[model samples]
Target: MADRGAGTMSLPDDWPDHANAILALNRMGSFDWDLDAGLMVMDAQAHAIFDILPEEYDDRPETLAVRVPPNEARRLDATVSQALKDGSENYGAYFRIRRRDGTQQWTHTQGYIRRDETGRPRRIIGVVRDATQELADIATRRERLEQDTALREQTNVVQLTTAALAHARTVQDVIDVLKDTHGLTHLGATSLVMGLVEAGRVRLIAEGPAGSFVAGTDVTGIDEPYPMNEVVRTLSPRFIESPEEFAAGYPILWPHITDLRITSAAYLPLIVQARPIGAMGLLYNDRRGFTAEERNILVALGSSIAQSLQRAMFYEQEKDIAQGLQQAMLPRTIPSVRGADVAVRYRAAAIGGSQGRDIGGDWYDLIPLPGGRVGAVIGDVQGHDTHAAAVMGQLRIVLRAYAAEGHTPATVMARASVFLHELDTDRFATCLYAEADLATGVVQVVRAGHIDPLLRHADRSCRRIPVPGGLPLGLSAEFGSLEYPVSTVELDPGHTLLLCTDGLVEMPGSDLDDGMRTLTALIASGPEDVRRLADMLIDLAEERGGDDDVALLLLHRRGLDAPVGGGRLQQHVAPGDPEALHEARHMVRAAVHTWGARDRADEIELIADELITNALMHTEGAAIVTLRALAGGRRLRVEVEDSSSALPRRREAGESGVSGRGLLLVDLLTDDWGVEARGGGKCVWCEFDVPESDRRRPNRRR
Candidate 1:
């Protein structure tokens, strides 16, 4: 190379014709600068770089330096100084320079600096190339590099965030992952918008940054619309590069956003299953614009988040339906039993999850037994889910079956336990079985690893029955072999028995004894009825030990000699012929027998026939018959009823009518007789007293 280190002389020094002929070049430029003097010199081609005439730079470098753009002058000086300090023989920098016509063009100057022997810089010489084409080429390369870098960064962020969003089940879970993974704080200021097309509304389901925004506040009614509205309506992604842009579009959110210092934002429409349900917006505090790549990544995350929300809502609805169905299958109210008052209460769990709606294993039953007896049972299986509830239902049916077979309390429990053990079940259960016979005023109890029942006596005192306890059912192979002895107590009149599950007494900070004391206090207060008392007791337990499910059954014994009576019967019949009279007599006899007047059955039958025969022969069309049975000191009074609209005409004993003989027979047989009109019907009565000997006979049919 000829003089490769030449300062501003890298091109041939020949005439313009020679340089043009060598390379068929159309244009060229060269220049020199005097740094200390702040002067510059240029050739004809160099002057053309600034679009200036060649005479403009003759004998003066100041003209060219002065022609340089003011804003780029400092940059040009710095480049010149840097090149001289590095002692580079050749160097180039691209900058903007002003032309004499007040227009601008890009230039690339390449040159070197001349120095004295002491290494001090003297003058700067450079070749000024009109590099508008070169500048365009470099800018194209830079643009490509920037685009690639931005795309790479977006791909990385989307891949990482998508993985996190994939695992988010709840709205809170999404917020947590975003905060932790994306270095985001102030989560509460953020809102998740979900579209509700059916309601023609958009809902804010979840918000983060705990104290900033209320969890359930609805922004639907805000005065000015949100940019997210566009996202949803258009089903596209949108972004606000600055707070000014957002405020200009949404004036109402401006104040709220300014107070939060939100400067930039991205609104992404959430589309799932090829449908757009809503949009999500990410707000930032600085005016940071999201790249196209970033917007696309956010869209992917929004889609996944939308799908998760849909699934969660579906799960919640399913849980509610299952819970309702389960409760409907349970008893609404306990059955009524004579000689005893009964009550029951049931409760389910309050947890949320897959097993949330499955019933627990706690259960209670009050079955009426023969001879005015009531069978009571309270049991709990070994789990808190649907399987346990199924086992409990099976045990209940089996217990009732055994009781119906007339097994003793201990026998019923023994057989039930054995059946449960033999069943192909993986869970065990505890139970307490008891029977109360109101006639005998006795209670028989059997316990199998269950909580003991509490008895509140008529005296306002309490006692807990201690029966022989056995292992929980289903745990032993020889379940019935373990004889659980029967325990009995005299259930006196006005006394109450309470059977309950462990959930009643097993409170969080208190034990079984404390629960028993609380229950005892409740029962001792003497509630009016068994049902009322049962409710009070359950409420008390819930106040103290509501962590678990509760089940309780209460029974109150009535006095053995309590008086019982029958209601009136108003009957309408056609005027009786002989057949009608016989039917009326049969009805009176059956009524007296059902009212426990069996000893007077024959006498009442004959008296009713004579009275009814007289009424049928006297009245026309339909006749009403009435029967009344009054218990009077070992005797029953019988009444024959009919509607005559007129009183019967009685005759003296000497009167010789064909029906006159009927009254004489009634007077001879019965101790008393009378006639009275009851409403629209008249009652003719006769009484028969039981003999002293007959009264002592046992009433075997109860």
Candidate 2:
């Protein structure tokens, strides 16, 4: 072989016979391009295929730009460069080239790379051929099949959009689904614009892909020239295929969005039941037109969106009403109780769960009772509807009345049960009532088929107090078992009592005891402030997302000037009951010693016994004796209340007698003494000052 000319190479001696004839017969021409020399050698047939004469084309590859369009040449260069960089041996591509008459025709090319020993491409040998007729023939054969495939794909997009819209419960939810990346964005829309028809105006509710909003298009009149407005007013879709048409039709909007380079857009009216509710627009920057299939898909999706929006509107409207009713039924403000910190919270259940009621029967109330007592109530009606809420309101009112009327905890619960049973509806309710005397640190709890309450000690340790219970409010009266047992919990200063409906103590598939243990642990680790602890618990319930509503009440006894390590014990002493008197004496002695008053135990016990004896002797009824440790265990107080209103007076005792020496002994051995009118009776109380060092005594005494 020899180099015959600058752009030619002579055939080799070992070349196969008729090789040139074979290539010519197939209308293929060959060329060789040198990477280092920047030269391309083409045969006569190759020159003809490129619509250039042998003399017109120089050996430089750039000369081919006369026949190849700039876009096509760049595309080809990219294909070849990628193949060379990726270590590919060959590359092929179809591109359009301008013919001699300035008409473009499809051309196909195949090239093989020749690399040096180091894998650096040095040359490329390829063949080019005319592919215009071949492509035209294939397009004719597959046109119908392609159309059907496109239609199916468009229809599938509609189905997917509708399925996603099915879960939209609110207007914002529908907007989210539409704007999601895997949603309508998958259809290659560069921007989405949506508007609702409100009061004869098109209100733009959503428009995105950041910075796509036009300033004055937020709210447009129905007669405005905006595309969305046009579609909504006409109840028909408007497809803008070109920027010129858009600018001509919407001159006001086009000037504002000129920088977006939008080439086409489809604005569809949101129609349901033959009425237009809104409009949506899908804007595209890369395409110039929409096919019939695409138009149909967008219209169908618009219909689905319209229905979803209507449903969401109705849902929100109903929810507002239900929430208003529930709020009206619940207590507007919790009455402040002295000597205690109180917090109450209510959380509605998650919608679309087991019972998708946005308004529930859960409720909480705080009632200020007489004599420095506060009543805390938590209850839940059987159902999760307005009926349940109505019943709960009535029950709450009656329960508050009973508690404020000085009824005992058990009686309050029993009366509430009877009231519920007498209601016209057949609903049952679980209730827990606690009457707490903050001054005395005693809480009387009554439970009727309700979860046990939690007690948080001053040390932050928490435990469940299992108060005995009767049936639910309505069921108890029906079954003739209205006895709600009273459980007394002695709360020290800084101690808190937690009352809540079972929703806070019941998880799916878990035992009630297990849930209680979890709640106890949570409370133990919670903040000491009652308000913060209540917020934390309610937040937990919100995160758990259960089907039942929750009602919580937290009452923390304030530590204002309260003695530390104080305790109270009460016992009844009957006039003629020897056993009652013995029990009262034993209780007084034990409490006095245990309260770090061991040095004065004898005097305190003697004072308490003499007071009890005087009350029994002077009064016609039993006496109530109460022993309390006060002043941070620095003092012990003894109280004996009798049915008679006679106040005890200091009297002298006979030298050898015991009958008149009770008050005299109480006066001599006590640091202070007083008598107060208690209802129809009088209470004689005495205090004994004990040294703080006595608290360090051994656990047992001789």
Give candidate 1's whole-model lDDT.
Answer: 0.66
lDDT of 1 by residue, 1-702 (tens): 112223233333333555533322546666556656555655567766777775554535545676677668778778766777777655678788877667778887776667779877766655667778877888999998987876666666656666765665445655566566352222222433344332455666544344445333354632227665677777888878887788887786666646667778777777777666666777777546876666666777677667765665554565566456446445545778776777888866544333244357788887776434578888888876666777787888888878865566876877788888887788888988888755546678888889888888877677777777777776643543557778887777777888888887776677788977876776778576777777776777655534467788888776554212242333455663556656666667666565555666667777767776676777655554555433322555555566555766557656555656777778888878777653455667676765655546543343
Q: TM-score of the candidate numbered 2?
A: 0.67
Model 2 CA deviation exceeding 4 Å by range: 1-132, 140-150, 352-355, 562-702
TM-score of each: 0.46, 0.67
Rate residue 467 of model 2 by lDDT: 91
Mark the 10 consecutive residues where model 1 has the least summed lDDT.
1-10
Give the Cα lDDT of each candidate. Answer: 0.66, 0.84
For model 1, which pairs clash?
Answer: 40-61, 187-208, 187-209, 188-208, 188-209, 624-642, 625-641, 626-641
Q: Distance (Å) between predicted and true CA of 544, model 2?
A: 2.3
lDDT of 2 by residue, 523-557 (tens): 99999999999999999999998888899999998
